[model samples]
Target: MSDGVKVIAVNRKARHDYAVDETYECGIELLGTEVKSFRDGKISFPDSWAEVINGEVWLRSLRIAENPFSSIFNHDPDRRKKLLLHRDEIKRIARKVDEKGYTLIPLSFYFKKGRVKVELGLCKGKKAYDKRADIRERDIQREVSREFRAKLH
Candidate 1:
């Protein structure tokens, strides 16, 4: 088996807004049209999240645009898609989510072995100060890398 998954998109803002504790790769149940839409890069992860219900995980608020050329049928852009995860993993996620200030956010979407997979993160919301600090640290690192490159030139 190869680990070369074709990543579709990553939620860059999710990392900036939340402190991710762990990540889990889970399969997504999608319609044929929805899969085609994703292949065309017509998917958005804005405000998307995972939820454990009835001992199963489900993705909510994911937007996969319809295939405009297909007039006969169209998949809903926003639908609750089921996620394939083990029972123990679901239990662990449920427990983590029940804790105060913890959340389940979608980190990225990708295709692994011809299957659509979503990377879900167990995260805690970051405070305003934390966001500012991250921004400052990123700027400092960017400046250091630039100086290092200039010296090599």
Candidate 2:
């Protein structure tokens, strides 16, 4: 099968704030109207997260706009959606979270093979110094690239 995945939205802030250790690609369960609205690029969430509860993974805080054409049959804007993942994988992640300093965050949202998929990251909160150091390193790399480009001219 072709891997023609179309990315829908990304939570860039999550990467800057957390150090990701592992990632999982999951299929999301959505209502018909919700999916319609999502296709129009009307979905976003600032503090979204995933949690393993009762042996299942659930996505919380995701906001999908109501399709204007749906009338009174629209789905809730902020609803908990189930994520499809292997049982063993869920257990493994749960163990890691219970150990402390680990969190489950939605890294990105996309469509794969005409279906909605989410990239979940197992992350640890980064310290203030860590973020500052990352900024310094990025600046250095950018400056070096610019100097080389000028010299080549």
Candidate 3:
């Protein structure tokens, strides 16, 4: 977190579906109009994920909505944006991805010093029982907090 950073969108489903192990801050290659759209909060990462291809990380299924004012030079809303990451970082992440059940997921997007950045998470999909356990743990925590608040009042 810094002075000029502003969060644009977050993929809540990522947290619900995956057990995030590590995070990476990476840059996104965006068109001029796409930046405008992002600033206006017209972006989504519903079915989106990242992949390492040819030693580069590519963001797939990130939808930046079309800017209405930018008529002809608008970028495609469904383009696979390229991610800017260091060579060693990409290789490390790629190796982790090659593991049996690991994948890359975009957790959130934001602006850092006027440049858009994506928070990429190294995650593994959760089993049904894992998800249920998470839900149960959350419920127990909520009840404990509620009881503490009641005693304080």
Candidate 4:
């Protein structure tokens, strides 16, 4: 939302692996060094997921690289980070997660008004056949677009 805010990393695989139904933006609880590392674009969302515990949402498995310039105050690269969200939102997410085969995945990480935020999604795992179908459809669409562009030219 702020002028300086930028998206650092996105989990592109999440869209291919799961069908995301809804998305929510939530703040991340980060240490000083972790924020610095994120600002430097040293973050990964691979294998990162969100879990609801004790009526709160937490981010797990995200890797934030250590700040190279930090002398003595480096945070753990794989520590679980708490996500700040409203109680109603947490409850809704928890309820959805309780359903069979539903999951919460981190889609992307970005900055808003100088604060770090994560885009979380309610997703269901996709089958292998579905992935293949998606690839085929994308190829068809690309070909069609190319043909149309050629005609226009």
- Global lDDT of each candidate: 0.90, 0.91, 0.94, 0.90
- Sort all candidates by TM-score, best to worst: 3, 2, 4, 1
Instruction: Indicate the worst ten consecutive residues by lDDT in candidate 3.
Output: 94-103
Winner by lDDT between candidate 4 and candidate 1 = 4
Best by lDDT: 3
**Whole-model lDDT, model 4:** 0.90
Model 2, 1-153: lDDT tens per residue? 247888889999999999999999989999999889878879986799999899999999989988999998999998899999999999999999988768999999888988888999999999999999999999999999999999999
The candidate that achieves the highest TM-score relative to the unseen native structure: 3
* Backbone clash count, each prediction separately: 0, 0, 0, 0
Cα lDDT tens digits for candidate 1, 6-104: 988999999999999999988888999999998998988879988888999988989899999888798888889999988899998898898765789
lDDT of 2: 0.91
**TM-score (all chains, Cα) for each model:** 0.91, 0.95, 0.97, 0.94
The full ranking of all candidates by lDDT, starting with the best, is 3, 2, 4, 1
TM-score of 3: 0.97
Once fitted onto the true fold, the runs of candidate 4 whose alpha carbons sit more than 4 angstroms away are: 1-4
For candidate 1, what's the RMSD?
A: 1.9
- What is candidate 1's CA lDDT for residue 112? 88
Clashes of 4: 0
